[model samples]
Target: MTTILIKQVSWQQHQPELQALRQQVFVVEQKVPAELEWQADDEDAYHWLAYGPQQQVLGCARLLKTGTLGRMAIAKTARGQNIGLRLLQAAMDFAQQQLGLAEVHLSAQTHALGFYQKAGFVSEGAEYHEAGIPHIHMRKKLSPQPQLGISNGKFFVSQHKNTVLTMAQQCRRQLRILDYNLNPAVFDNQALVDAVSALARRHRNSSIKLLLIDSQAVIKRGHGLLKLQRKLSSSIAIKQLSDDTGVSDNLVLADDCGVIVQSLVNPETIWADFNNKPVAQSKIDHFEILWGQANANNDFRLLDL
Candidate 1:
């Protein structure tokens, strides 16, 4: 892999290299019309350039304050070397930080869908031709809002609340956890190991199962927890949940307090207990209902292993 340095560029300083790359890729190679290519207010637009160790510009992109991101180009020599991703990352970061934009939208060429997808941009609708080339709108959610609460001390979004960045959980006490469709942050193996170890120390000789939900296990990073499960061994049984399924409402019944951790995208409607604690009884019941449906048959496999 080639080493690349990303830096914000003044429109004037980067204009020559940027226009050349754009003319090469979008105009000459992709047949984009010169009329539509470079016109309008580019002076106010923020531009970025990627450079090699020798300060040779390898890629460039511009983020106009229209909530629209466009004109990203990578030199032909830098193609397949991931310079485009670096440019997009820089562009998105600038748009979020300086512009405070909620979403960065782009009309991505159809063939480049995979590239954008890897960079976290989701395709929205049907493809249309622009300058005779097929294109589609793509958007990436830049500021990944946390649900609330940290796992041990490091920042981890609450997949349930969709807003709060909760403090990390390091206590050994049994927790009365709540459920919300949350996108919990990916945890390192050591953290998972610590969680499993803590659970073991708290619930010694008790039947404690590791309920792996669809969003957390398969969707987010399936293989991560699978590795943690192996390191944990027979201490906790791994249960898998289908995408449509949820936890059993009686998830609280098996233990003194339940630990509910899932992505907050599809939150369980309930938020607090009668006493206003974070634990929600009704949602816990729903979790139990879904929990019973999860296939108990053990199947934790890691691709790398």
Candidate 2:
């Protein structure tokens, strides 16, 4: 077996080799037009190349600062050797570790959806033509590294009401949210609404479980999350806590890896967000226990009100 090595190289360091490999795979082999294969964004992206034991470039991919992964191509001879997966993993690592990005997105050719899907990416949107080939947008959220202490993890503090949405974008498998009133000001924003919808679309097998003290506000506001729950009813679920449950903290847990906890419902209240696995898991376990006893909100008509 030939040992394959993957490296992050600058455009100045491996432009010729990267361009040659992309041309061979995207242009010649896949029949993509040369004009569409090359783009100005390539100038600023971080490129990863896979090299075989003999130092031959087997594949290459690039990561843009905006969390877009593009120009991924594996050599014809290197197909079925797991080089593409290695390259993608490298790009994702750089994006999360170096760029501090919460998620990575890509426009995958429809035929390659399964390949990426196996590596944890979720496909979204309708299939569309790109460079005369069918393509779909895909995304994968980066899981935060486990931290033993609060001082060692990435921390976020915000009075901005969209903090929940920011936390949602970092979720990969599960999103457990506990809030009072299922606040419309927080869940009804267009951006957060779209993020939830995208999350449901991408992670069809995952779940977003919501526990709220009251649903009247969400129902009265015609919130997007409610609409999304109706459309993707299986992937998302809602429950209402009894008035005496004594749940005062607003919490958001992402995949048992990251968490955001707000002590009160006031927008001005200070909140803490971090990527501590143990802490997040403890909260998730507590939430599940409470959820088990919570009452399901099956009234769809309230969402329409």
Best by TM-score: 2
Model 2 spans with C-alpha error above 4 angstroms: 148-305
Q: Tell me the deviation in Å of residue 237 in model 2.
A: 55
Error of 2 at 256 (Å): 22
For candidate 1, lDDT tens digit of each residue in 71-108? 88888888888778767866775666457788898999
Against the reference, the lDDT scores of all candidates come to 0.56, 0.77
Range of the 10 consecutive residues with the lowest summed lDDT in candidate 1:
158-167
Candidate 2: Cα lDDT at 278:
80
**Superposition TM-score, candidate 2 onto the true structure:** 0.49
* Top model number, lDDT: 2
Candidate 2 lDDT tens digits, 76-158: 89999887887887787677756889999999999999999998999988999987899999999988733323334544332
Task: List TM-score per model, in order.
Answer: 0.48, 0.49
- List clashing residue pairs in candidate 2: none
